[model samples]
Each structure stands twice: as C-alpha cells, then as structure tokens.
Target: MSKKIETDNTCNTSRRNLMKGTGLAVAAMSMIPAATATQAFAQTSEWDKVFPKSDKVDHQKVPFNNRYGITLIADLYLPKNRSGQPLAALAVGGPFGAVKEQSSGLYAQTMAERGFAALAFDPSFTGESGGKPRNVASPDINTEDFSAAVDYLGLQPYIDRQRIGVIGICGWGGMALNAVAVDKRVKAVVATTMYDMTRVMSKGYNDSVTPEQRGEALEQLSHQRWADAEKNMPAYQPPYNELKGGEPQFLVDYHDYYMTPRGYHPRAVNSGNAWTQTTPLSFMNMPILTYIAEISPRPLLLIHGENAHSRYFSETAFAAAAEPKELMIIPNASHTDLYDRMDKIPFDRIADFFGQHLA
Candidate 1:
C-alpha cells in the first residue's frame, strides 16, 4: 500500500483520510431517482470507432443489458484464429466521460492480440448505448455495466466464465474496483489511469473543498432538479467536458484525445456534448472506493502514470485494497497518455497479469 497519495512528491492528509471510508455508500442510490431508465436503442452498422480496426482480432458491435436493465453497446474483440477451446475473457471500458471507441476499445483490441476475448462497451446514456435524456452517469448502474459485460462473455462458447477478468481505464478504473468488490466472478481486475469521479466531484482536487462548499454545491444540485423538471426530460447541458480555450495541460491532454482527431467520435459525450448537470448529485454522497478493500485474494492490478494528474486516485485505492494487489506506475505518462499511446501502455505486462492470474 502506498504511504501517501501524491503527485510530484506533494501529499494531502485530508484526501487520504476521506478515501478510507466505512464502505457504507454502497446502498446510497435510492436518494436520486433514476431519470434515464432503460429504453430501446438502435445499434449502428458502421465502424464508428476513433481507432482503426485491427487485423489480428475479430471485432463486432454487440449490446447487453445491465442489472438495471440499461442496454449498453460494446465492441467485442477476440483472437482471429483460435484453437476451438475456452479462453480467458476480459471486459474493458472507461475514463468516465469517454466512449469505448477511444481508450477502452484500444485496450480491448490490444488484449485480444495477446489471445483473450475482450469486450469494450459504452456505458448507458453514451455512445451507441440506451438511456433516456442523453448523457448521464450513475454509480450503481455504471458499475453494473462491467458485470453485464462479464455476463455476455460468460455466455459465449469461446469464453471461460470462471477465468474472466476486467480492465478499466481512467474513471472506470475506480468502478472496476467497485465491481470486483461485489461481483466475485471477476477473477482478475486491472484498473489503469484510475479516477474516482465521486471523489473529485465531492471533495475537489486533493480534497481541497470544505464542508461548507459541499453544502453550497448540493444546494445548486437541488435547484437543478427543479430545472430538470421544468424541461420535461429535454436535453440538459453538461456542467463539464468543454474546452473554453487556453486551459491547463491535463485539460489540453484531454482535448487532444477527445476533442481532436486522435480520439474523436461523434457519439462520445466528452467529444462534444456536456455530461448532465445533475451528475454530481449522486456522486457527492456515494464513495465508490469504500468497498475497494474487499477485492482481495483476487489478483488486482492498479496502474497509473507517475506524472498523471490523477495518480493519487490509484494510490489511495491501492492503499485501501488488500493482498494480492499491486500498483504499477508508468514513468512519465500523463492521464490521457494511457488513453491511446500504444508505446506507453504496457500491453505485454497487462497480458501477463491477466494471463497469469486468470490461469
């Protein structure tokens, strides 16, 4: 376990303390009404991913239902030439606001090259998925999206359901940990470039926000509900994911990946539209990492770039998690660098971790 949550050797005591919660936020979802419930979604026929399709893997767009019944669309990746036997499988998704086409798809495609059945899917209300009122996030349902992927993989004749693993990039990394805490079937989990969206939303960066400030923000979220009611389920503008010009380097990194050609996809929430304004309402009270320690004895790998702005997310999570867990730091890589930088992403190491653990 890491002694401190830091970036560039700077640490914060408040953030570390906040991360060690009593794991009570697991059942806190009845607070918010699930606005965007399950709905019929159209699956596209064209290859709409930002990354090019790989020749070494067989890729397909598929849909599966989460426990919440939300329909999610995912790009399925598998080894092109298999020996007609059950193989270890992996479900990949994340970076919070990002679609599967950008980072998760790349991870899935790469892992498929290393001989695993990988599925990269869009969370509900984003990409080719189904949810009403456009873009939104849910602590409970989003976590279920991972298990739903596992459910789909387990049904496949080529997949070994018992030997299943999962990989989550950026914000989904935190959700991956949350999923493993509840879903014991996930034998191995590798959360790379993690971000606890709830932590960042409720506590600000490094837990800098005061209790008073949190109260004030909640007041605003309270008002937004009235605004949402007034709109009658109309498209609500997102509070985040817009570049207003000349921002910080990390935002620039995200802009480069999401707003530009490198990882731009029309359906991605981060690429153009903003996430819904009420996103913070559920995340503020719910701590996603509370049950992280329970994902023990199962091989857990938390990877992050040494210089990533969000490095502390993985650090704090690693500290809370129990045995058979390892944290791997990618030297000189930033948060978005792991998104699509094949050179920085250790596909070989990730393959080794999943291969050995799932074996």
Candidate 2:
C-alpha cells in the first residue's frame, strides 16, 4: 500500500537561506497565517543566520504526475516583477534521500528569484509524493522524474518550452546528468556537489570496496530481499551520519545539516529513515552515465567544492562529457556548502550559465 509522510512543522534554516533572494515574504505576507515573526525567527535561526530573507519571488505548492503515475509535490518559485517575455524554466532535485522541502526547493526558489521559473520536486516514494513501499530507488524511474518535470513545465503558459534547464544537487546531481544525456529537451544542466550513486554503491567511496567486498554486498542484498519477502516488512537502515566517536568529516558535515534543525525536514530519508535495505543491488548494477558523451551541444556545468570528499565524482564526469562542458571548483568549501551556502555557491554564475544556454 502507498502512504504519504506528513511534514513536520519545523522550519529549516537551510531552506530559508535558499529563499533569501526571492521576495516570497512580501508577496506571501497577506497569505501567511497569523504565526508570530518571533516564532518564525526562533524556528528558523540556523537557516536564517546563514541565508538572509529575500523578498523578490512568489512561491506556491504544485503537484504533478510522473510517468509512473506517482503524484510528485513541488514548490514552484517565480520571479516577481519581471519584464519582457516568459523566461526559461528549470527543474531541480537532489541529495538523494532528501525531499524538495530541503536543499532542492531552496535551489529552485533562489534561481526563480534570479528570473527563471524553477520547480523543485520530491522523487517518487518519498516526502509528500505518492508511492508504495516508501524509500525505494530505481535508476530508470528516478531519471524519468526529471523528464516528467520537463513535461509539466512545457505545458505551463508562462514558460518557454524550448528553453528548459535542470540542476541536480548531491546524488541527484548524477541523476540529472544522466537525464540530460538522453533527454534533448534539457538545454542546459548544472550538477552541484555531485555524487555518482552508481560508483559509491558499487565500489564504495574512493573504491574502498574491493571486488570481493562488492560480491559480499550483493549476496547480502539478495538474501535480504528473501528475508523481506518472508517478513513482509521493508527493512530500514539509519542515516550514515548518525555515527558516534571518531567519525569522518564528511559524515560530521552531514550530521550538522540533515540531523539538526539547521537542515532537517521530516520527509527526508537521510534525516531519519534509511531507504530499502536492498536498494544497493540495483544501484550497483546500473551505471547511470555510460552514455554521458551524448549530452554534448547542450551545455553542462559541474560545480564542486575543492575540499569536498565527493569532488572526484564531478571531475570524472566532466572528463567523460564532451565539449560545451565546464568544471568549477569552490575553494575551501565542503559538499554540504553547495547544498545551501549562498556565499559559497556561485548563483550568479549558475544564472548566467542557464540564461546563455536556455536563450
């Protein structure tokens, strides 16, 4: 059976930072319920401190269908008081295990304030989206999520169908690149703090998992599936960052955001629940970017923090892609910095990239 997780009332600071440049506050002022500003401020302290409020965009809830018939939820952001013609549209999603309400929504809303139509959507089986056996992932279905967003945007009256772009953050960054590889409708693509999910699941980070280790993982997953069938309950694993003493910096950074009020969203799997215990099997067997070179002619922007533990994923992907591609490294920033740190993320550069290509 399918179920939708109810969103928590906690106001995320990371989300607020992503919306700072958008004039959503002023436009939605009257629409906002009688919640006290003090309450809002207190609940949003971590996020607000990092990202000041923006009062230049309009935000609204939007629901659309994917090819699988799952009802995906998104927060649509549109620039306020724009001039001439309708502009290009952008569809953003990512960090895998996370909902649109977190970093992806922030990215969409921020870009919208920069004068593009942006929609950040929750992938199937997660967040407010409708799906059965929650927290499962598939390479094909996930890639289709991007295409479905494109389909929805193309039908919008205020959008230029021919000029559509996409931004994928973290794990979704890899998925977005995979989408652009085959979908010609994507005119430009930006992958921020990217992770190649296939590589990590198959070989483990930094190729720490040897062929024998990989085989053991496969055997474990296969047996876990049989156990799941017998028990009739989806196995759940806790977030990797919930480590104790002597954890790695990458895990520590993840904890600071996903596990705390600063970035937590109730619907985020990474913030709480683990995905299906058997998800590794598919991710291991599927290499998402085997045809990455085909994405040429359309521009690709790959951004990563120089110190990010996952920087190699973007470097390798950039090398795999053909011309009309660029790789930008943010000095001294970590993986999560690109998730919501506006000062660290090159928004102006991203805006310019999309504008040039989508034009």
Candidate 3:
C-alpha cells in the first residue's frame, strides 16, 4: 500500500493556478438523445475495433468537442439489459498513442456489460478525431479531452450526470487524474498501467536523464521548430513500434501489441504512424501531476501489474495523492497484460469501486 498524504492547501492553490489556462466550456447542457447524437456525427456502422464486439453492450460512434473546439470521436457502450433507469457512466481513454479501437474500447465494453454506460474516445489530433496538424500531442489539450468526454456523457439522456466517473489507461492515466483534480464533476477515477507522460518526457525514463542531457534534448526540439517552420509542416519520425533488434523488453511488449495481429489497427499511431518532431515540447515543462493531491475527497483506484515497468509511476502517484485511494497490483503481470487480459485486468474490483462511489 502506498502511504496516504494529508491534504495541503498549497496543493489546492497550485491546482487552481493550473486550471486557469485549461478551462473548458461545455458546448451544450440540454439532453442529447441517442438518435440525435448519432445523426449529428457521421458514424460507421461496421465494427472496426481491434477487439471483437461484445453481444452484451450496444455500441455506436459519437463526437464531442473540447474547450479548444477540437472535436473528439468516441465509441459509446451501453448495457443491452438496461432496467430503464438513469445509469452511472464512465468516460474512458488511452494507453496514449493508441486509439479507441484498442484497449480503451475493450475496457468500455466490459464496463458496460457490468451495468454502467462507458465511452472510449480518441484524444484530439489522433485516430478519427478532428484536429489539424495531425499526430501532435498536448498535455493541456489532452487533459481537457477527458473533461470534454465527461461533458458529452453528462448530456446523454440515459446517463446520470452526477454519477459520472473516468477511467484512463497508460499515459492518459496521468491526464485523467489532472482532469479530475480540477473538474470535480467526476465522482471517481481509475487509472490502469499508468504512465506519467509529462514526467517521462521531461526527465526521461526512470529520471535517468541528467540536467545537461535535458537541456540538449530541449535544444534539439527547439531547433526542429525552425525546420518545421521552413517546411510549413512538422516533420514526423519514422513509423512507430518497429522492432529493429535488441530493443528493451518494454519496447518489445509494445511492438507485440501494436505491430502484430493481436492489437494492430491502421489508425493507431502506435500501430504504424508517428507523432510530430516537436510533440514533446509541450509536455516537457508541463507537469500534469503537480496537484494530484487535490483529488483527495474523490476516491481514486490505481491498478498496475506487479512486474510492469510503469508500476513506479502509479506507486509514486499513489503516495502523492491524499486519502481515499488504493493501489492494486496484479501478481506476475506485465503492463500490457492489463490492457486486454481479462483475467489480470481486475474488472470486478473496478466495477465495485465505481459501484460504491457512483451509487
């Protein structure tokens, strides 16, 4: 168990400061009936998800915009055997560069089967979402993306707005916490196989990058901006998830999921495409977990594999957070296993957490 910290007023003040530039305006507050929402967004009827469609949940494509007006495309999952009551709902996203078609969709569908409405969405500038200069990433905008999903879910007729929660996987887990810290509308949150993207980007893996190394990396990125300005377009790195040889075990794990038949999708960045050369510029200085303790009153569940390379992220996050938090570690499991492994994912415990909190 990670030691719980006492709430600090300074943390709350810092959280308020961070929220200044990341504010969101809910586009509409009126109820959005399913039929009208479906008509508003052009949805593909065909099942294109990497995970097989579940018979227990109704699935559909929907769109909603963030404060930046970047429209996000998402998959909505609802229980087939609904009792005609307003149901608790969850907004889901990430593993970061992966899309709604991969692990997020699987989590959403499985949660829907357990009796909550769930939405799995692509962050701005990725997958089928609407963002220009495709394949870019932003900590502020990406964290705002979750709140946007919450706004969309709260507008649905069948969803109980007060009972809404969030689930973030991989890198988005950090974003989820950042979002919830400010957007108090989310009643609970669960982050699995979490990665603090900003931390990794700024400090490098395991905080191994020296201060000199960090300065050099920033210098390179700054210069790349000049090249991008000259070309009138950001240059992309080579195709992602390619195994050249002698890669780290974690990279191998990522390749196995994104490059093989197991989790491959044409639209996923991790599957094949690449992010812009300057994508790290925004995340480098923007620490997303600076105010993690502010989510104290709202319960948080952090789930990680015992052997996951990213486990330290969740442990550290857990220690930083205030009370009403729990860190669950699945024995002998790797980070990617929680992405899709039903046995290791601990869906039952997740449902129990939301069930207790959202009720």
RMSD of each: 5.7, 13.0, 10.6
Candidate ranking under lDDT, highest first, comes to 3, 1, 2
Write the candidate numbers in order of decreasing TM-score.
Answer: 3, 1, 2
TM-score, predicted candidate 2 vs. hidden true structure = 0.85
lDDT of 2 by residue, 1-359 (tens): 11111124332234213323332111111122221111000111122222344578877778899998988877778889767587799999998888777888788889988899999888887777767777777888888899999999999989999999999999999999999999998899999999888877776665555576566667766777777799786565444346576655676888898888878765677775566666666788899989888988888889988677787788789888888788888877888989888799889999998988888
All candidates: TM-score? 0.88, 0.85, 0.88
Question: What tens-digit string does per-residue lDDT give for candidate 3 at 126-176?
Answer: 888988687778999999999999999999889999999999999999999
Query: Local distance difference test, per candidate?
Result: 0.79, 0.76, 0.82
Number of clashes in every candidate structure? 1, 6, 0
Model 3 pairs in collision: none
In candidate 2, which residue ranges exceed 4 Å CA deviation? 1-53
lDDT tens digits, residue span 261-334, model 1: 89887677667555666766888889999998888888888888876778788888887888878888777788
Which consecutive 10 residues in model 2 have the weakest lDDT in total?
A: 36-45
The alpha-carbon lDDT assigned to residue 268 of candidate 1 equals 72
Winner on lDDT between 1 and 3 is 3
Candidate with better TM-score, 1 vs 2: 1
